[model samples]
Target: MPETPPITKPRRRDLTLLGLAVLLAIGLVVVLVVRQGGSDPEASSSPASAMSAPSAAEASATAPIGPLGDLARRQADDPMALGSPTAPVVLIEFADFRCPFCAQFGRDTKPVLIDRYVNKGVLRIEWRDMPIFGPESMSAARAARAAAAQGRFWEFVTAVYDKAPARGRATLTTEALRGFAATAGVPDLARFDVDAASVDFDDAINADLQEAQSLGIPSTPAFSLNGEPVLGAQPTDVFTAMIDNLAAGGPANS
Candidate 1:
């Protein structure tokens, strides 16, 4: 038999045709399989998973409502209400009394804010003593609580902060704090002094300090407006925006 002729090379056109046929078959199979199932990725997701995904509104609503949100909503709504019981927002101020920023807030920005918003009954400002500035701070906080018992808390606080030394010193010697109480028109100075030294007052300040530590408040002049915690002496606009947002019945931004 004659030697078998060398196998002829497959025609380029035939190879190309074969490759196209294979690709077409694969594409058809893919199309058929996709059609058998739901073609949309969104449609393919299980209902439970779909439900777990947050909507934009839901995502935006996760702002820090603070540890006291429910309590604040129920008991203290006014953000700046000094004595008003009907205010709609409450501002929980955590202060060390000896922090310069606290002094600045109390002396400058606070007055303006108080006169403009607090006095108008849009907010209720409630002070909580952190006393991180040491013994003097604890003393001042105790005295402040004593004043509160006599309904002169705001006055005593205002006087102490207003006259705070430039170097962030707020001496709270028994006599000095008493002097502040007197200037703030606190009657029964002797009674105030006794109350300040009482175990009750010390316990109250200690409790506030413990709570502040638990809440991770690292500095003075921190605040929670409507139970949304805000750190540092943020600008007036921050407070205004929160008040405005809450008033609008919208959750605050994180």
Candidate 2:
């Protein structure tokens, strides 16, 4: 019979130290998230009709309206401000950061859309948040607002979803949330913290929810190309076709 292998006590100690290091790293990440403020705990929905009618400021930036243009511009927040002002075709995405489907769409199809259209100045994408996933979801929404406060809304939005755990939940646990803000390239974490704790972003998030409700957007990853709604996590081809059609100045299909 082969001799029994000797027990390695020193190896066990080394392994224990390695485990401690990893745990410390995780704890640090959690700390960063909290300090930076990723989400809020006070978000809730409001009546869609409660959203004030458009003001003159909104009207001035809207696209040309006759029939089709009127329908398209109605849902658009800005006519000259698609994803980037230069893009002609506008893509409105009503999303929830905590929604697994929305994250998947962001990870899978959005990059392609950006690369093929946004980068090419053909498609302008606007992201609207519908924070319906509980308290933590509110935090996530607030974090985005904080980022936008520093002119990094899209960057922060992308980072939050990207850093979310495999379960796709934003815990808003202070540390976890701050980690996201740091990654989003926000320069003023302190101010962001104060903003996160305030009611500044409440109206914005509520307004977005109202907008979605106005458009009958009951679920997430709901997309629109020039006012035609597309429900569910659709394939890239579907988006491509809609975008192409919009770019051609064709009437949108409901």
What TM-score does each of the candidates earn? 0.66, 0.66
lDDT of 1 by residue, 1-254 (tens): 79966545676677888999999999999999988675446645778545543331232243334455522322233222262444456677888767877887777767766776667865556667788878888878878877777778878878888888877466778888989999888888889988888777676677777877877777787887766788887777777788667645566552
Candidate 2 ranges beyond 4 A from true positions: 1-82, 165-168, 252-254
| Residue 7 lDDT, candidate 2, scale 0-100 | 55
Please report the TM-score between candidate 1 and the true structure: 0.66
For all the candidates, what are their Cα RMSDs to the real structure?
13.8, 23.5
Residue 225 lDDT, candidate 2, scale 0-100: 69
Taking the tens digit of each residue's C-alpha lDDT, what string does model 2 give over 1-254? 99988759998899999999999999999999886563322222434423433331243233322221222333344422235544556677888878877877877898899888888867777767788888878887887777777877777767766765666565666676677778878899998888777778799789888988887778887877665778888988888877776666665431
